[model samples]
Target: MMLDKVVVSDILSRSCVVTDLVAGNKVEVIEYLSQLLFAENIISDKALFIRDVLAREELGPTGFDNQVAIPHGKSPAVRETRMAVAQLRHPVDWETEDEVAVRLVILFAVRNADSGIGHIKVLASVSVALGDDEIVEQLMQAESREALYRLIVNNTGL
Candidate 1:
């Protein structure tokens, strides 16, 4: 289950942006996804969804290092297994393994725990992508949303 399989262009288009994401932790990740779901007309109760996702985050932080974070949950509030990625213009403390501030956030919403494998595979793919310093540098240097998207799609085959 490559990320290209689960992360479609629409989800990528929705969340890819260069901005200062003021909320820097798990709470922020949940809120970001909730807002995305609402804005995309994918969910109605933003508060409930955000709360559930945040609660799941309490068990452990989702920060995967190399300036990336993948936060997800299996909750009824999730209408589908959707994914969205965002790049913050400024780094924010996310409490990852390397203790490096996170600049990119990937949010995933699934309706069942059985989807864990799919999510893990996607994360693995992303981790592989990030392992290439050139790829990560190119992604960070991307000037426009379209350029950033193309970089990801081309590199990840998404």
Candidate 2:
């Protein structure tokens, strides 16, 4: 998808937002998010998709200093481009530049045959919005899944 045409709604949905996710580690978090995508039919095979996500993780850290992690996977297992956002029930150590614990996780499921960096472009848009500390704080403080969904849509304008 074209960068200008991309919006947060393109990859995010009400069902994809989780406010009280409880993950003990990166693997648990990734698997949990993959399950969400699988249930939505966005990922055809959860096992393969999880492998792809882990492979991408090996390329480099997707974690940010602000208690956020954006882990993505582009694979044939992906039926659509979508994202899942979770505010963990508890924070966990992540491989971030500043070694900050991650409380928010953004998982991206991308189709392998995509024409361009559609997901990354969307991520750029999200990153820009997340740059505002106030927005990030509000997202972290969101009381429920529905509230977090609205907060992200309102702030990211996607």
Candidate 3:
């Protein structure tokens, strides 16, 4: 069976991409973005989704290199896969592999059954887009939500 390719634009919307976000810590960051998922009608239960995301974080920090943190979880509460990207006004501790404060937070949620290859493909594509220095630089310096959304969608070829 062939599954359609998943890309950033598929999950990310202009309304969900936030700039100058004011989050003090990792939990706050996730909480803020999770609200976007609920408001966008992607997740049915915000609290449940948040709990799952936090649990996934406990399993292992999603923070990686390049001051980027992609915090995500798979839960039954998710009605559809979605993403919210936030550019913080100031970096926050995410217990990243390099111990660098994360300036960009990309939050994603997926249906519980998607915990297979489909899940890996989605995350890998997002990671690959973020791995590009020019893309990351553009995202970090993006001044508006529309611009940020465009960057993600265009850079990911979604």
Candidate 4:
């Protein structure tokens, strides 16, 4: 798929957003998100998907500075390429590159078959969108799921 084909709103759902996610740690956060996605039918298997994400986490840090995290897993369990947002009630300790607390979790559920090219492109789009400090600030401060959705729509372009 092309960059133009990657619509932020297409992957993101207002229904899947959680503004006040209360998780004590990263593992709980991962499990919570995995369950949420699976419940929404975005993923076929919650347990397997969680294992995939944890395995990916073992490879390297998905958490970045400024309390942001983009955790992902590519598995056959993924039924859809979807993005779920969770703004934590409080920042939690996460294994981050800059070693900062994580307050914003963006979970990416990806199909294993398309892991090579499509995965990279979609992820890069989000990365580039997040590169803007203003957008990041907006995402961090968004009060509602609608606000979060609109921020992504504007920043990620048409």
Tens digits of per-residue lDDT for model 2, 108-157? 88887654665567777788887788898999999998899988887876
State TM-scores per candidate.
Answer: 0.76, 0.92, 0.92, 0.90
- On TM-score, the stronger of 1 and 4 is 4
lDDT of 2: 0.86
**Candidate 1 CA-lDDT value:** 0.65
Cα deviation of 117, candidate 4, in Å: 3.9
| lDDT measured at residue 22 in model 1 versus the true structure, 0 to 100 | 52
Better of 2 and 4 by lDDT: 2
Q: What is the C-alpha RMSD of each candidate to the true structure, in Å?
A: 3.7, 1.9, 1.7, 2.1
Better of 1 and 2 by lDDT: 2
Residue-level lDDT tens digits of model 4 in 1-158: 44446667778887778777889999898888787788889998899999999999999999888788899998889997888888898999988877899888888998766556555666788888776778888888888878887877678764
Badly placed stretches (over 4 Å) of model 3 are: 1-3, 116-119
Please list the C-alpha lDDT of all candidates, in the order they appear: 0.65, 0.86, 0.86, 0.83
Once superposed on the true structure, which residue ranges of model 1 sit more than 4 Å away at CA?
1-7, 15-26, 113-120
Q: What's the lDDT for residue 44 in model 4?
A: 89
Model 2 scores a TM of 0.92
- Candidate 1 residue lDDT tens string, 42-158: 555677777777777788867866777777666777665666666677777876887888777767666564366655555566667867778877877777667777777667642
Model 1 root mean square deviation, Cα atoms: 3.7
Per-residue alpha-carbon lDDT of candidate 3 for residues 88-120, written as tens digits (9 for 90 to 100): 999999978779899999988888766667557
Which scores higher on lDDT, 1 or 4?
4
